[model samples]
Target chain A: MSTAVWNGAGRRIHIQEVGPRDGLQMEKAFVPTAQKIAMVNALSAAGLAKVEVTAFVSPTAIPALADAESVLRGIERRPGTVMTCLVPNVKGAQRAMGAGADELNLVMSVSETHNLCNLRMLRSQSFAGLQEVIAVAQQGQAAVNVSLSCSFGCPMEGDVPEQVVLDWSQRFIALGVQGITLCDTTGMAHPAQVHALVRAFKARWPQTPLTLHFHDTRAMALANVLAAIDAGADRFDASVGGLGGCPYAPGASGNACTEELVHALQLMGYDTGVDLAALTQVAAGLPAQIGHDIPSAIVKAGPVHQLHPAPASLEEIRSRAHERLQATANGL
Target chain B: MSTAVWNGAGRRIHIQEVGPRDGLQMEKAFVPTAQKIAMVNALSAAGLAKVEVTAFVSPTAIPALADAESVLRGIERRPGTVMTCLVPNVKGAQRAMGAGADELNLVMSVSETHNLCNLRMLRSQSFAGLQEVIAVAQQGQAAVNVSLSCSFGCPMEGDVPEQVVLDWSQRFIALGVQGITLCDTTGMAHPAQVHALVRAFKARWPQTPLTLHFHDTRAMALANVLAAIDAGADRFDASVGGLGGCPYAPGASGNACTEELVHALQLMGYDTGVDLAALTQVAAGLPAQIGHDIPSAIVKAGPVHQLHPAPASLEEIRSRAHERLQATANGL
Candidate 1:
């Protein structure tokens, strides 16, 4: 049984924690700035190389991230931890830069319908805004990453063509963007689509860094991630507890749960440098915080090899037997 | 934006629902035979091509399956549904035959350690038992299928070699086993492993039918399925609502959720002849039935393309906004 270790691309898989930004944004309750800060601090302590701290969109647009600055200001700065904030436009970019964000992520939906529905802007306008955001971030000396939302498939437009994503990606990279994250906003990406898109993107921009943000709404996120990884994508965006849904893209679930993703990568002998047990513990705390049970498989079932204590006594065994009986009785 | 219709072997992907046998045996609860019948009936209503109805195991060994005969007799058979049962030995095979099971499935753990721990018998003893079971089933004119458990990996002895699975498969086929299921007992198989194993298994056993039974313990179940499909293995075993865990393996989750698997296959343009929305409705009833939430991704979040009703009233929009605020306030 020889184990193969993946040490490609000068680094192992980079899991960018998106709980604070992508996760909290879709929830119904307002996470206090301090709690958001604490979540970020906890995620950083959990050995996440990059944390998407918050999005710097207007408060009216997304009230969940209204206190982005305070959250960024409150978290303890760990060396080598890259803190990022999402910027919808140049104005958001300026706000994130002023808040001392290490990285600025400018997002523009690849599909015209999604672009209009999500950002309330035309595709051309969003691209223009992205160009402006990239210029401003560069001027501020902050690393700029561009996310092509609905790059795989769109809820409104249905199937998004690869050439569209590729054309937009080249445009973004030409504007001095540092990285590209192909966002499966509505979870419409299948494995083949992910592989083809990532392979094409990588070939066109070999030097540019690529990340994949996948949702588990269709249970294809991990498969898509594998396809992306096989296509040379090293970085990915995931939520801690599979929190977050697309408000615009109806019925879409949360991003790929970070703990489960890490567990899969680690078991595959990919060096994620994430403590699976610790991440599982942190994920356990999320349901209470979110006021709802999370969609994460690892959080509810625990890790792949996690062992429950053997039935200590005959009574315990009998009780387990009884419970099993009830489960079977109920026809499950 | 082209969709590939999966017609590798036939028009539809054959789904063999294994919850009744593989799933129920792992639970501690002794589900009543009548309830097991109801669950099988439900699965049939959900359009499954086949269902593994029960396991005829010893009362002393797997107490949960003590009433296997009663369970097998109780199911309300549906048209075109093939009811199968697991038979561990010649005695079990005889019991299954007497119970009027449509098919008799012989399970042999591929790894010697697993074979011992699971069956308390050596590899040769298990093979001998399989031969006896096959002979008995053949004499009864019942179809015999062999499931090679721990074919991908084992708990006691990690990473069962590919050759071991191939050798066991060859032996089982030679013993007149008509069908084979390669099971990832411990969820330790990767896509590459699945691809290699399925390709090799098919190359050697071109005439023998192959089915893939996978567990999502490490979140690689679906990926492995896709790899196997790409490698030309069409038939798969899935549980409704992703119900079931290994009785012997600690911390193992259920089989690949049927709804999620069907959704993936359909989205990839593979005709599964399954209505995902209808399955989702059936899956929603399982949590209450099982007394715990199943680790199915699609059940909680719905499919990726399922659209939610947008807030129609200003008050509703305000309520959504307020909920988001509360989520943020709660520090989620």
Candidate 2:
């Protein structure tokens, strides 16, 4: 049947795997530096376009990723995969560049309340810090990107004004940022919101690439991704095996899963260019690495086309069915 | 902000709570008959337009639901609620009618492989059995609805042809079935497929009502629901607390959760006419009832608009920010 879903017109969506950084940072126990490096190396080899290696924030603040420099130094970076790292301030930016991060991603929240709570800095202070970081990155000849956390909504501040987000994007765009990633920090984004915001953001900055970071705390990440795709936004930040948990919501799921996201995109005629089979092997190995089960649906359910055979009782049931028919005929 | 999602023009979606029947059937432990009845009562009272109370399948087949007769007899049917129960054969139809079922739901799998395995009857035999059940229901003046299982795809047979589903729907419509529920038996239903099938179904049979039942095995149930909604299908079958599990996909999640579905639809401004607050409480008490935690996103993450206050550090953060700014100014 010629339908919309099966029409595999050669459309492509870019994926940035952030599990090593975003997912690993949320773990209570520190992942070994070697394991972290291996995970990042496996992810890069899996055909992912970008890998957020680790954050250069204060090691004391997030000791789980304290070995960011060592891990960055160890990983084998593939040619097409751009190795990115999060830098919260100019110092982090300097360290990230020294560690050889191809793209320096700076983090700030759109909501003043969230910025204050998350970074202990005023919104303007974080923005100004980003300017300094961007300047440092420019000096080092490193590409700079800005990650606008809680661009959707703040866990504490409720609904963020769209104008607040647009204004910050405009300001960041003026600072020569190469890419802007709007994050749903607590899975607060709805499809319509994603659709409207992505459309609005793309309309404002056609040249600068846009990315969406979604949490599956509310199980709407894929739905939100679809909405973003329909709005013509291509890039997304996903974690392999759906690793990570929300600090705000206890036991809340983390990002839109990388393999799951890729699986859906590939099925729907949009090419993600990531090897789902190899990517799943990476996800399959994550539980042993992290010592916990991941919440990725594809991992649990298998791919949509994976067939499960009929239960083995079919042989017995055939005879039983014949007996039942005979008995029914006799009873009638 | 007159955006697409904000413009809610009062489109209504009808939810059929199948937790008491479909969800519980998969449970290993037997929930008390009183508990089953109370659960059904609570669901019907929560403004769900339809509640599938219980199945009249043979007790020998499913001992967990052996008290189906007691449950069906004990539940209080509220006005504006259609109490439906599964009637597998003419005997089930008679029993369900005797217990005062408003709608007798006859089930058969669209896939021959599934029908034979699940029902121990060939596809033609299942169709003949449905004819007998429909005839019995007609004599009792009870409404008949057909549940076409594996209409999306079967685990045993991969990629059930869309034409197969369409032909079955045509036959069921010809048999005067008032409503037909297409079930994603193994979570094979994707959004685009759901959209195409829903659009095609509605176009062919405008008068016959259609309902969509989906499992969240691959976590696309809600996304598929949104796609179905966009394609003009309004009815959905959901289980409370995301109860139930697929026999096919071990450890896979169950149906689209009732409260989570209601939460998203309500946030999107679609009127479900079901009280989300009351529904969530019902879902909250389900882990105790079923002896396990459900994977319902709303149960875990709360509603989209439920605000998580900023950590109790507004005063401290403001002072800390002031000190950081003062230190920066002194350096400046």
Candidate 3:
């Protein structure tokens, strides 16, 4: 590792806000389509490089994000912000493109066990199916990004070999997919593991755009992000209010917090291009809308730069100290 | 920064638990003396390098830790674990030594405003007062560690100059104190700031043990620890279950989580000399004793090595996938 690894000074770190899609997918209360659009619109204007607006999966599968089409079409898109959405199959890809998604995000678990449990299909079936979906998505000229779940390690299966992740990434890259996201779905990725895998991925395909999605389940998300940055990664997926959690591991936090990550990067002199104040303001409104407390530290404790007023009793204390010092000096 | 900065391959990281003192100070409920003793005993047996057992300050000032002397004397002492206590003045230092504390931790804020507000004295007064307290503790043969609060940045006054921190550290080191803990009282410390400060501190006094104390108030504690390690810091102060909060900054987390820090370090191949499983177990029992939830991620999500059984529906999904694949192969 070089000094550049720890010092992000002037580096352009890409932040992809995934709250509208990944964060809301786990919510029991369905967010109104209007509210969903409003959230995405705010995030898009917050200078994020991308926003995973909504998932174009079956409404029955994830009723929480049932308004995928409405959300994708309704949100105001900024010129630099890529509006992306999860597309599970050919039909989903078509619907997502039809709804005006700039990028079609296809996902599958790297772990065979997780792939079967999550997608209800074998890994091979998923690969073949996604290949067809990619063809469909490319026909519509939408950029494609494949997100490999359990890329770090699977909760149930334990270690998903690093080769498996790279293999999936290599295959997706060969297919001309624009990007790949290595997701630590269960927050099982540690710094050492993240650095190694990221280095290997960059070594093999340095030109391919890579994004790291992390869960704060074990509170290693930020540390893992730092490690990835050290290993030449610049893009990250973060959720507003740190929303979303592993269904496999209940009570665990979801994605890395968007505001927290942006705040940190900005403080380190990284060019994150995120309006942290506006983003935190959006995150601050989440609890009221979602009807639950979020796991975001920034939403609770403002960014480090937000200074507090001195204690009101400071004057009294200062005067008392002054008096005591004078009395001692005068030999009273 | 070098690769050793990011890779803690065989480096030994020292974790000092400060939950019993720092964590409990903010709690309104008075933890029973017996329960406090039991908690300290459990932590001591959990293979921590040191545990800040309790604060020997005025019982009236912090009624929650009123039983500090009884709790300190009653806890079972482990041979390798050093028991330390916060001693604000000469009387407190004498009381701590009489109660069998292995180390007396003296504290003051680097920020003049914070020192006045917090200790109701000027920085010079606090320093001179603690020097006398140090002399008193030296007579009792107790090791001394000076903890400088708001070494990173003061919530009220904002930036505390790096020169100010180093100057205070130099003065204390000249007093022949055993160690100095740089306290990020409000979690304002960032990775860059931490790296620079720790690097400077280590450069000037490589032989004097330095401990980095951070808060997760802005969710940057773990990241700051990583940066400090990069700057040659090995010792850290963490609270069990991420206990403690800033009285000035409401809704902010207190200290870096002990189990989370140890778990991360161990994953990075650092020798933390901590029984993570035992520490997590003790942390798990905290909510019941404190009558509130703790912010420990490991206690909720378990360690990465703790494998979860595959989802119960996995077998069914596997069979379903097999049938679908077979049908597809037969072109049915």
Candidate 4:
């Protein structure tokens, strides 16, 4: 993760498909554990570098992901793919580690109001609990990623200070975690904010890998991605079919769509390792499984370069145009 | 426009709403002329500097916009707003001028195959007709903007050569037109292509104003906007509710949503001269007007910072969390 180890020019972009975890958790109707496993296996087979298969929050808290263990056990594990899970507490951390999670993604918000509302825990209590979880994760030899919710702005508190984020990031670094994800939990991150914050973070923590998780709620996620890239942040967490929105976060919508991100990056000549065509087919089947139409433009309309065939009168028009051009060429 | 004349830092962004014409043209259900005019006037009232009211194509060619003259005559033209109409031929130009259009947007395709499929004429024929139309527009004291279709790429012919676009742009410049629109007729534009093209065009002709018209066919319109801005293009053509698409262009979807563009620009601290809230309401009414759901994310998700009220149990969570924090702070 050091700048010396970092590839020159920030060309490598890693996509951690969070659809099975973050996306399915947004659905009111619980997706069957078997189907979730199938999707994880499909995503793994499709060359995704990482997949957050499920979250290990209390079932009483998020019933949609109640069968997280079952899904984790059912999926076929691939050789090169890292399987990750979100764990909110010591209990969840233990359970996720027992499920053989390659990485444990921990969470809290920089906004105290958001942290309390989202997890019903004081900021200090959440950090204390996370300390115990991190110890357990270390004992288990599992990598940990601390995801900071509302890192840019909060619904109740307006804007979260950059110092608070940088301070907490330092705390996570002290805890010997793998990396950090600055989550735009409610899609409040803007391009300028993203650029300045990401640049400062990279300059401050050049050795820590940064992942940007964006929601397309305000239609700035993709733009923010570009800004992040311009500012030297490359890793992103995208959900397939643009799945994942917070029901509690009113007017909230899904993540930066996986296919859209991939298509855009690929068009810009950035290699994502994930095949867009294969990812698109997987996205196309998501609506049926989730009982709602996805908010994906690429799924609705094929790739930007996918062409429509010419009309039936193409021959007649071409003949007429050729005749005119030929007649003009011959000076008729 | 010259860089010296542009606002400092290129902070000014122009949005030309093309919903009244391009949007309704794709709907199978014919909208009343009165309703069309009402929408146009409402858009102008919403502070949109320009609105493309309707297209004056032959009724047999495109019946959806057959009542173009009625719509043009019915609208209450605001002094600050430039009311525009699409004109494909000399006859269309005459009808548009007679109907009091402030600007006639002449159209042809840079790709010969696209021209053959769309206009059923040779490229030379279309240009010849456009020359006559331009003369008529000049006589009527109406400004003209020539929209070159498939300026990025074409479905029928694949990639349209950049030389062709630049060469055609030069021709339009020689024809005494006021401005030029590089249309992404099939959403075949990416951020890199957009940035490079807009930069090339601006460097070539710093005097003529350039407008980018993009479809969110692959969910890259806003990203393309960012690129065009980075490359020095300011004006763009957007559709309210993301309502327009080409029926002939397979996989084509709506233009960049007006509320989306305005919302993104406003968030990025750029002035778009359009009220996003007022525009969102107008866009909300478009699904009913078009007999289909609109493709706008802002219209569905609201503005980026429109915070939702906290849950009813927030008091419970606050008390419980504070109690836990106090107990832990006391080391009890």
Candidate 5:
């Protein structure tokens, strides 16, 4: 049987690293601003093209990122690295731009319940806020990416209609957002829905750069990514170590682990310019640092076909060899 | 958006538990026969409809499962549970039947290199052996399921053509095998390849039960499972705590972690009947037993939206809420 090499169009999957901002934000420990900067710098050294550095929300709102300005200034910027910040309104956008954020991410919840609970604003009010944030980012000459939260399915209002996502996408694109990230905020998406939505979105806005942010809450994140990729969407947002989830949504896991995502992409011969071994090294340290083991498969198990050292004793060697043979025989 | 409810028919996914035989066989520690039985019993208690117990191989060949009879005798079989054992040849089949295995799993490697290296036989010889096993198992009125290893791709040979998997499937099914499992032995399968193989196999033999076994070595196991499920596959093979890997296949992780599989399936609205919280309890003990952390996502992070207890003080509550609010705002 001849091997079929994955010759899919060699479009590099852009990984937007949300570790420092998305990962540390949820931690109980007050990761020092210096540690946050170090983590971001480490991510840059790890070859991540985009790193979400910090959030510019009010300190009273998020004490974890209270020193967002100092954190941003502390990062050792690498050439061609896009350092992004999450901004809620015009004030946050202005602050992010002033702190040297290369990109400003504007978010608006698609579901009214989520918008009210999350942003403390109604759907229409959040859109109004988005308009202001977009204006500020544009005036500051910084790229703005809009994330449509709960685009796939919402916990508060389940099964968000494709039409709603499409309508909001058009609005954001028309408002001059460079990219539109469709988020499965509550993990309510199936493959068919993902494929249909992505196909429809691409058909309507062919030129819009579409990014997918999926939570592994339902284990459909990677599957959804596959469907979307098949439907011609490439860029995706993943949190390293599968960190971060909606505090309000029950049973939602973090965004797809970046290592798992990278491993999947590289195996399919889709170059994402990520070093799996390096990523694993970075991830290995996370469990100890955060006081909980990370939810990543490859980091713990290592890569496939990885050979552990054979036992020195003859009996052990024979036993190990036999197990290998049985696994082979079992088609495992 | 309406709440996404699993529509029973297309949503019921079957998980084939391979922990007992595949998982324990690969471990360095010689799991006591009693422990193997207890583990199988625990797995059955956790609601697995099928559990692959032990292999009926020569003690000289696989000493780890040499106590197959003891393991089988010790297990407290639950009603409706399909207890399976791996059989290498006709001799193994006789032993399995005598030991009262509910099902006999016969394996043949599709790739000649793997067949020779692991089985010490040519592909035709392995097939001939399978025919004998099938004949014996049929005479005893025992069920036989054939797994074609390296069906998608091989570590030594690289690409495995689709026709090879199709041909093997046809041959195995014609031999009165009730099930066929495709093994991504080296974790080389891409989603497109998986979809193509499953579609072709399903088209040719729609009635034959199909199962997919994949390793996370390439990080495409779950993604491939999604593709296969989309292509009409309902049964999968998974290991508890993501234990077991093919020693012959360099760099492969263990079988897809049972916890991750169950989490994904349940979230997708496909009922596998396994209680995830119960499985997590089972998984929590695996790392200590194996001396390494199992490659399971849910085990580390717990379920999505798993809320940590809030602090008692109002000041602490306000601070935590603010942090969570900021994290959500950042789309972390």
Candidate 6:
């Protein structure tokens, strides 16, 4: 496989669907609780490794996900698919565990400025709060995954030192978080930067389940993903239909489209363990479901395996060309 | 330097701007001839290695480029830029050379179905006709480049064997063509296939200047480019503002956006020789000129280096947080 050429793993890539939470949280119109449940169920049934179900943050903070409890209660859990929920504080963490979330996804920005703007707290305070949340999760049945936003580059800080990310990750790992997701919150990640950071991260914590979350704000998401893979990172966080945009970067695009990544990886001979056809069918309906057009290339242009019929007039053009050649040959 | 991880060249990558020819050819509205000339001039000035100025096809066949001669005459010939024009036949080749074109980009499809549908001729006829065109170009000051469409995979016929593309390329090289372009005309290419084909082509014809032309129809163009580079292919064909689409595949996007590729490459530590800022300035104006928004990511969301300002309420939020911390410390 060409992936071998880049020094990436040939093993099956793990895909975690984050559309239900990361994606829908950015939607202006509230995706009804029923639709959110249905979306999560569909994604889980499609055999994703994990599906971030919803955020357990306060309704006043993220009104879009105000129905977090209703959605958690409504979903039918599928075996082998972990249902995770975003937890902003110990309160949200307890709420998520009470509602039976399989994993608690704790997020804090690696950039102090971004942490303040995004979480309304300093990085120190956010870390302290997440420590409490992790402590709470340790008392429960759910696993904990810490998502470090602005792990690549901060919109405000420009570049977050690699050591900063490592230190925060190390701190979280000390608390026994099961996973760490490095997020390009506003899509400032480039391929080289991703490869370097991922390599450094892996070298330090090889056994930790690391997920590389990318946004296609500048159209470098998939390329970054490829670079991350080459650096020995396999897990990815993608949203359906390329849902979710950055509130900070006005014109930036959303998370890397789930189907786009799966389609490309499958073609590159990487077993993504994804049913692309099933995923695309669900992705194709997202435009109407979200009341907007999507940025998913696979949904817009069918998979490469899906053949487009020869131009409708192929035979007609062939016959016409034959007649013209005949006339020219006859010297008419 | 992470491009080092991919075993690709650290040398400056060549950028060929094809928006004027391959891109404008698909537009429904007739972009005014003057605008076309200005766009070409701007692209040439932006340090592109080659600019596909226009096509010399029959006006009846491509009315959008009816003013090809005028555009060729009007564009300021930048000293370092090669002004290439698409030549479909012996007549077009003659016209392009006569109009001061620096290079003639001759084209045919490796896939017989695509050849028949697109050129209304069989692969044999295309090869024979291109041979004649090559003979004509040999008599002129212009260099000849053969662009093999569907070299990756045909939308109608599916996979075109890598051997077929190489065989055609070998034939063109035998005809003394200065360049050979492997075109993924409908964007069916994936990373593995591109890497394999490019490796084969480079190994077989080490000296020939091979350009990889990819459409973003399926959004794998950049990834394919990265793979090609890893396989020792350097030259790429990209359109500004992603200004073209496949007629056969509905909803398919255009050629890989030039600025997007340049931005990604620049960030990956490879020099593309083109000025991204200058190129993006011209690309930003394309939407107004074309009467539609484009898919160029850098143009839409400014380049990664173009930092967005921090949100306006940071200090206020910081002050509030500090005040709350003081209140809490005081046991209020």
User: Interface RMSD for each candidate model?
Assistant: 8.9, 3.6, 1.9, 6.6, 8.7, 3.0
Superposed model 3: Cα runs more than 4 Å off: none
| Candidate 2 - chain A - TM | 0.93
lDDT tens digits by residue: candidate 4, B124-218: 88898899999999998999999999999997678887889999999989989999999998888888788778878988898898999998887
Q: What clash pairs does model 6 have?
A: B244-B254
Best by DockQ: 3
Model 2 chain B: weakest 10-residue lDDT segment is B1-10
TM-score of 2: 0.96
Query: Cα RMSD (Å) per model?
Result: 8.5, 2.4, 1.3, 3.8, 7.6, 2.1
Which prediction has more favorable DockQ, 3 or 4? 3
Task: Give the candidate number with the greatest lDDT.
Answer: 3
A332: Cα error in model 5, Å: 34
True contacts kept of 3: 0.77
Better of 3 and 6 by TM-score: 3
| Location of the lowest summed lDDT over 10 successive residues in candidate 4 chain B | B1-10
- Where model 6 places Cα greater than 4 Å from the true spot, the runs are A1-10, A319-332, B1-10, B326-332
Candidates' C-alpha lDDT: 0.77, 0.86, 0.90, 0.84, 0.77, 0.87
lDDT digits (tens) for residues A128-230 of candidate 5: 7689888878888999999899897666456678898888888889888898889887666666677678889988888988888888765667777776776
Q: Is candidate 2 or candidate 6 better by lDDT?
A: 6
Please, what are the lDDT tens digits per residue for candidate 2 over residues B29-114? 89998888888888989999899998998898888889878898999979988999997888888888898899998889998778
Ranking by TM-score: 3, 6, 2, 4, 1, 5
* lDDT by residue (tens digit), candidate 6, B157-184: 8988888988988888988989999999
